[model samples]
Target: MEINGVEIEDNFAEAFGIQVSRILITAATKKLALVAATEATGYGTSVIGCPAEAGIDGYVPPQDTPDGRPGYIIMICNMNKGKLDHELLERVGMCILTAATTAVFDWMDEPDEKLKTGQKLKFFGDGYEQTLDVEGRKIHSIPLMSGDFLVEAELGIKAGVAGGNFFILAENQPAGLLAADAAVDAIEAIPGAITPFPGGIVASGSKVGSNKYKFLGASTNEKMCVTLKDEVEGCEIPENVNGVYEIVIDGVNEEAVKAAMKAGIEAAVKISGIIQISAGNFGGNLGKYQIKLHELF
Candidate 1:
């Protein structure tokens, strides 16, 4: 299939099931809220190496927030529920609680697990911590140097989808990067979805394991590398495709992930020098969901 004259490879993006915690972080202003959100989601590019995979889903207006303050929604995802709970606790406690004028609230309504993140972090307040009902929700008030930190007593975690991804092949490096930037911008508007890679773009895409390194769990996907197109056997890089970038998306559900991919691909094809769109998969050997790229249109 072709979109905006750019070829869409007949491929599918394989995605796996994972646990997710959606948190609404509010602050005195949008800038402060974004600051906390960015910090909490930092170093969360991929669960392959990182403790967790996370990103800012979107911004929440004051009128829509539980605290009536400007906030940002973030999603933290992990394969194991126990690890996801721990990640939630650590990120909120260390990142959000330390940020000035920041507060956290549960964004998921029906969660498979409820974590006492606030209850655990309240220890930072010593004996002065207090619990109160605000907006019909229980909140922990922890005293800090700037002011009292408010966190929802309980945070929710639900099963979500992860590792939804696609590739952007372009004529040159600048074109590939620009196309990736446009794709990330489109995915940012998608609710319940996030691109966790740095700036929502993956410069180095990897495969299941390393061929040379026995201890490594993942290594570069040489087949998709434009630089190795001639050197690597069975390479997927076309003759004219000199630059390639990957966009990995994680979301609350399969539908959200699919929507983000479709939006990103469509937006990317409009960029100049975009040659083709494709996806990565383990020949249907891994992941639970296989989203077809051609079917998206």
Candidate 2:
């Protein structure tokens, strides 16, 4: 199939099931909220090599927030529930509490697992912590040198799909970069979906393991490497394709992931120099949720 003249490869992006925690961080302004949210989600690119995978789901307006402040919605996903709860506690305690005028709130309703994120962090108050009701939501306040850090008592965790991805192949580096930028901008606007990589683009896509190193969990995706096309097996790089950037998406459900991928691919297809749109998968071994690229359109 072709979208806006760009060929859509008949491939699927591999996805795996994992646990996710949705938290809304509020601050005096959107700037502060985003700053705290970004710091907390740093180093959370992939679960294969990193501790967890996380990204900003979106922003919450002040009037809609419990504390009447601008908020950033962040999603942290892990392989298991125990790790998800632990990461949430550490991230919220160190990142949000240390930042000035910042607070966090649980964004999920009727979650399968409730994590005591704020209740655990309130210990920093050392018995001087207090509780309040803001807009019918319970808020826990922890005393700090700057002021009190307010957070919701609990965060909700549920099963989610991760590692959903697609490749944007272009004729040059600049074209690939532009297409990736436009795709991420469009994907970021979709709810319940997030691209965890820096700038929402993965230049160094990887396979399951390394061929040379035993300790390496993942290695370069040789098939898509244009320069190594002559030396690699199963090379998927076309002769004219010089640049390939992958967009990995994580979402609350399969539908949200499909919507984000559809928007991203459509946006990239309109950009000049985009040659083909493809996906990365391990034949469904990695995860059960395989998003077919052509099915999205």
Candidate 3:
């Protein structure tokens, strides 16, 4: 299938189930809220090497937020409950709690899979910790040098899809980045999904494991690297393609992932330098859901 003269490859991006926690960080201003959110979600890109995969879902306006302040909503995902719990505890305590005028809250409620993040952090107040009832909902607050830090006692964690990805093949580096920028912008508008990769683009795509270094869990994807097209045995890089960029998505469900990919691909192909649209996966080994590019339209 062709979109704006760009060929859409007859391939799919595989996704799998994982647990996620939706965390809300609010502050007096958007810039300060971002500072805490950025620090909290740092070092969290992929499950391959990091403790969790996380990103800013979107910015929430003051009117829609519980605290009536500008803030950011983020999602942190991991394979199991224990890992998610540990990551949230560490990141929230060290990053968000330290920021000025910042407060934490559970954006979503799931009784069955709740983590006592605020309950755990309250101990930091020593013997002066307390709970307050705000709008009939009780939240824990801990004393700090700046003031009291308020947090929702329990955070929801439930199963969600991860590892959804697509590739942008372009004529050159600038063109590839242009397509990627458009793709990222399109995906950003959709709620319940996020591109966990840095700036929503992966320049160095990786394979499952290293060929020479056994200790390394992942290695560079040589076939996708245009510079090594002539040297690699199974190079997928076309002669006209001088660059390739990948966008990886994780969302609240399969439909959210599909929607994000659809929007991104549609926008990307409309750009000037995009050649062909494709996807990346570990064959059938990565995940169960396969989102075919052509079928998305």
Q: What Cα-based lDDT does every candidate model obtain?
A: 0.94, 0.90, 0.89
Off by over 4 Å in 1: none
Give a tens-digit lDDT track for model 1, residues 178-257: 99999999999999999999999999999998989989999999999888998998998989999999999999999999
For model 3, the stretches where C-alpha displacement exceeds 4 angstroms are 109-112
Better of 1 and 2 by lDDT: 1
Tens digits of per-residue lDDT for model 3 on 1-297? 898999999999988898888888999999999999999888878999889999888999999888899999998899888989999999999999999999888886443478888899999999799998755656888999999998888888888899888999999999999999999999989888889889888888899888899999899998898989889998998899998999999988888899999999999998898999999988878788888888899
Best candidate according to lDDT: 1
> What is the alpha-carbon lDDT for the whole of candidate 2?
0.90
Of candidates 2 and 1, the better by TM-score = 1
Whole-model lDDT, candidate 1?
A: 0.94
Residue 177, model 2: Cα distance from true site in angstroms: 0.6
| Residue 185 of model 3, lDDT score | 95
Clashing pairs in 1: none
| Rank list by TM-score | 1, 2, 3
For each candidate, what TM-score against the reference? 0.98, 0.97, 0.97
lDDT, candidate 2, at 149:
92
